[model samples]
Target: MIIARILILLPLVSANKPQFPLGIAVYANPEFDICHRDMRAVMETRDLKFFNSVIDKTRIYSWPLKNFKSDIESLHNSPLFQLVRKMPKGAALHIHHKAMVNTDWLYLQTYRTNLYVCDKHNHLSLKFFKTPSNDCNWQALYERRRNPLVRQVLEDRIRRQMTMLTEIPDRSDTNVLWEKFQNIFTFLRSFLNYRPLAEDHFYQGLLELYEDNVMYVEVRSGLQKLYDLDGKIYTTTETVNILHDVVTRFKADHPDFIGAKIIYAKSRDMDHDELRSFLHETVELKKMFPGFIAGADLVGHEDAGYKLKDHSSLLLEVSNWTDFFFHAGETQNFLLQPTNLQIAIRHNAKRIGHAYSITKEPDTLRELKEKNIPVEVCPISNQVLGLVSNLRNHQAAILFALDIPVVISNDDPGLWGAKGLSDDFYMTLMSILPMNANLYSLKKIARNSIIYSTLSENEKAAALDSYEKRWQQFLINVTMPFCDYTQVMYSWLTLDRNTW
Candidate 1:
């Protein structure tokens, strides 16, 4: 009797079953460049490659622009298109605030509407800075930059600088590429700090995610430092208040869009005392509103020279009280220890942001597998950071194989130069994981977004039910002639439609 019961229960535990949910995406912040979700001009151009780059083998269509018309009718009838149409991502659990707004939205904030950022000798500083000049279209930029094709040169530089991930990973001659990424963010920082500007960016980014099928966003925002339009240096608490207002307003405007669970972030440069103050702010946020501020994150270059263990005490304190949604093991080279993972396991982490280095420790990997902890996988960010040069070598691929759940995210889609959840999905499909991954597997991955999200159980169940219904309806609509669930036709006549 015991052996028979165990045999029956084995199927639930031993094997992987598909539980895919399709919901629209919701970004943590609205301003950041989130690739396939939101793109302007340059980032826009990369969408086709980003979206089609993955799952293209199974995709019935040739190019995204060519749409379905370029392919054979039979191609459109595949399970691939069905997955694409029906797949609904739950939420962007880990997006950065700077990425919530596009470079274009930031440009619009400034009086000089044209995005003519000049790069002389590969050192890019704002050209129209300190002056509100309206004669700052691409034409004026071309004349100032001197190359007859100055606008094109500047645009190419902007495009190249904006898209640092597309470049080849050459650690040898790294001066140009490394500086370019920081400079781009620095330029972005100058624009996003103004309260009004930040609000606009935040709103737009969430809208973008909503269009791409993301339901909720738990975005990371830097509160340790502020640099931009604001003269006074507001404390972390003040920053959270501003962010709360922004998200609240945005959510009010769009009833369909579920807003942010502010993941208040601290940089590695912060001292131990500063870290405590940051956590205090997070605790206060929890007191303010249950759903408004979700948790805390350790953003920035953790490998820049601080061990996560340096702040272990404070981390433990936060874990003792509040939940921690950490950016652990993001570095490909510098961070050598797995202390953060242990911390998360001990504390009972909500979800790990970018647990890329878990493969290095065999024992820790076991702990994670046993805990069933989900890792927030950011493919483009890792690629740009040179952790996994391509998606083929992504750590998330291994984690997924172990049946450890992972939710795909665009860490800084604008900074990385891609759009929407589709970009990350595309990369995971083609370069990382399995090239021949079926619709069922892809849908399961999409569903993991909701599973790993901070959403309540009831909300998740409703969303999952909606997704299943959507899939069933799509199947019926697409394969109407073939689908015979009752088998009325088959029972009445001799037929052979047993195989799909």
Candidate 2:
């Protein structure tokens, strides 16, 4: 009789245990639970197939273990990726403005007339001119693309230069990778600096995010001055107005779109006075465009640049004027004293970008949890930039395990041919989170993006309400009798077979 009582109590004890990683309120809903089970089964089957594949066997332990550039095409063909593409991702809080749209769209812009391209030591730079001048061997791209053979070869070369895609992603030297990465931005700056093209670029970027089911975004933009075809330069305010116009037009076309905000980002490589001037300008812009300018951030590779604490007084002073979404702890060097993570927390950063090394600092992690500061985790960016070899070993997995607030973002999706937040979200679900993580995990993460966003409380509430409704509809769609998972898989394969 005692043994029987113990067995019955054992089941009760198991039931009382908390869910791993974290628990979600929606876990109690029967419909949601059923949907989650179905989704989990699909995810597990994909994992099994991926792990048993011949390529996976020779290369890495798992699918995400491979370089993102090499694996991105295959991921696009995945049924799981398709499902993620259809889900309502709450917000993209850490995307770079210039790198938001894919290179394919940028390549199409080269077809415009009077566009000049200068090739120097195998590096390409583009600019617009009313009349061609002998500036750095400026050749008319219009004439270059006139030949079918030349157009094909030149397009391929330009696309390759514009992206970071490589079969052998450099793993040994991060400095080399960063050098190449920064160079791509430099090459793009000339091409995108044209006012008309900039407007189109911003609009296309929003469309890409919207099509990927991301409702809102906070773009980390440099707010650089733009020039017209006749070399008429527009002031910073003019540029901001242009961007605002693009967002307004986009939202009008897509009524469901919640719109975008700019986190005016300046490079950390600036001197003390330069940053102070930039901060003052940022404050003035925030005043000018109250609803559009969300905050300020210093973006660049952390280790090589001045630390956040280096400009403490200026940052502290500006903290009263505007909020901060500082990029901190992106480095792999943990032994550095008063790390960026600690400094960012000290400065009361609203959101931490790429806190990849946060796991190494227990005290800092505790402080982040206590302060409820969310870390904008970019999984594929970290992997591609040589911060971590495999997503399974990424520090974000630790953050998830500890229940620390995390918002998955795409730092520079366009640079790698990724469209939106879906790629990063897919990586988080497949590799960062535990295999047992269910739909509740995804829901909670999506919700957190809104909660920790720069949106006002009222705006956040409305966004969450909208998100909840859409999420429920998604659940219903996936669970309906006519929604055959096998058919979806086969269809994706057929559609993407050409690329494969």
Candidate 3:
């Protein structure tokens, strides 16, 4: 009788024990549970097939590996990767506006009449006008690319100058890689910082994101001004207007697509005065285009730049109205003490970008848990930028295990030859996400993106409703090959919810 009582109580004890922290439920209605499970079943079966074929045979040259080189090598041609491309990713919340598109396109843009290039200190720079002085060392790119061999070399140089292709950046010298990374932007500025090209580039970037099945995106633009070829400068207001127009046009063409927003990011290396000026100007811009500028962020190498604490006063000046999208804990140097992350939490950041070291500090981790701040996890960016070596051991899995909400993003995807968010999503599922993380985890991640976005309440409701319809369609499409009439009818009934 005592043994029977113990067995009965054992079930109760296990029930109270914490299961995996699944974060917030995607839906309040329990009827959606059946829909989620069926969707999960299809995705899990597909995942198993992918693993059994590709992961089990990594010795084969065509498998997708963790690092940038191996992954990029197989990414373009893989059938499984194509499936990832088709999957409906809800939102991409952490892309840099400038680095949204690849450099190859920028190289082609330089050919748009009379563009001069100079080779200074072995670094390529571009200018719109020709300089008569030989001392200027400016040569026309069009003239230089006339010869076949020279053209090949010139294009190759341009590609290398704008991408992180050669080096494998690790913790020992991330600064070196960062220097190269920043220089790429400087090199491409003349080509991309012009008005017409800027509009085209931004639109093309959105096209790529849309093609990858990403419905919504929030890009981090530094609110820099654009210039024309005739040295005519466009103000920040004009730039913002151009961005708005581009997104509006894209949405018009793709009616089913949700909208995009901008997070006006600024360099942390700026002095106090510059920070104050930026805030003032951004506030004015926000007044002009209320919905266009969603929030503000500090964008730079987290290790070398000033921590958020240094600019607290200036930051607090606009904290009441302007939401903070702090890029904190993106470094390995401060493992023992994550000052950046701690300051971000203190400031009550809406969302933390690349909180790579948050897991180290227990107090900060707990605070983040209680506050429910989502970490924008850029797994490929971390690997390529030298923050983490292997995705298999990335701290994101630990954060996820602890119920910390994470949204996978493609940071600087273009620089690394990643076409869209699909690359990051594929990498997350195959490498970073734990073995037990299933389609429901993916569903939650997608849901968290909208839940944490700067969109208004009504917009959120509309977006979620639209997403549900798309998800239902996606389920039918993905499971079509594996399902027969009975399974199809069951899925339809589950989606109909009223039947229950």
Q: How well is each residue in 1-500 modelled by candidate 1, as lDDT tens digits?
A: 32222122222110122222222211121222212121111111122333344334434222222211123233334333333433566678778877755455544454443323434466454432333345333233434556665645655555554445435544423334445556667766644555555566777888777767676788887753433332455665677777778778877887756557777777756898888987887788778767777787776664565566677777777675577887777655534554566665666677888878778767877887787788889886666665654456678778866777788888877664455575677556645555334434555666777777777898777666665545434334333333354542332233221210
| Model 3 regions lying over 4 Å from their true place | 1-21, 24-41, 45-50, 53-56, 59-66, 130-135, 168-172, 335-338, 482-490, 493-500
> Which of the two, 2 or 3, has more lDDT?
2
Candidate 3 C-alpha error for residue 141, in Å: 1.0
Query: Against the hidden reference, what TM-scores do the models get?
Result: 0.69, 0.87, 0.87
Please report how far candidate 3 places residue 378 from its true position, in Å.
0.5
Q: lDDT score, residue 490, model 2? A: 42
Give the alpha carbon lDDT tens digit for every residue of 1-500 in model 3: 32122112221111122223556222223343323433344444223444444434353222323566555766655555665666678899999988998767766787787678888888888766634246568888889989887888888887788788755633336888789889988887776776787899999899889988888999999867887756678888988998999999999999977889999988999998988988888788888888888878888998785778888888888888778889999888674443889989888899999999888788999999899889999998888888776777789988877878788889899888887888888777667666544444465677678878888999888887777677667667665544565767675666653221
Model 3: per-residue Cα lDDT at residue 498: 27
The candidate 3 region of ten consecutive residues with least summed lDDT is 6-15
Clashing pairs in 2: none
Write the number of the candidate with greater lDDT, choosing between 1 and 2: 2
Off by over 4 Å in 1: 1-86, 101-179, 223-238, 334-340, 469-500
Cα distance off (Å), candidate 2, residue 482: 4.5
Highest lDDT: give the candidate number: 2
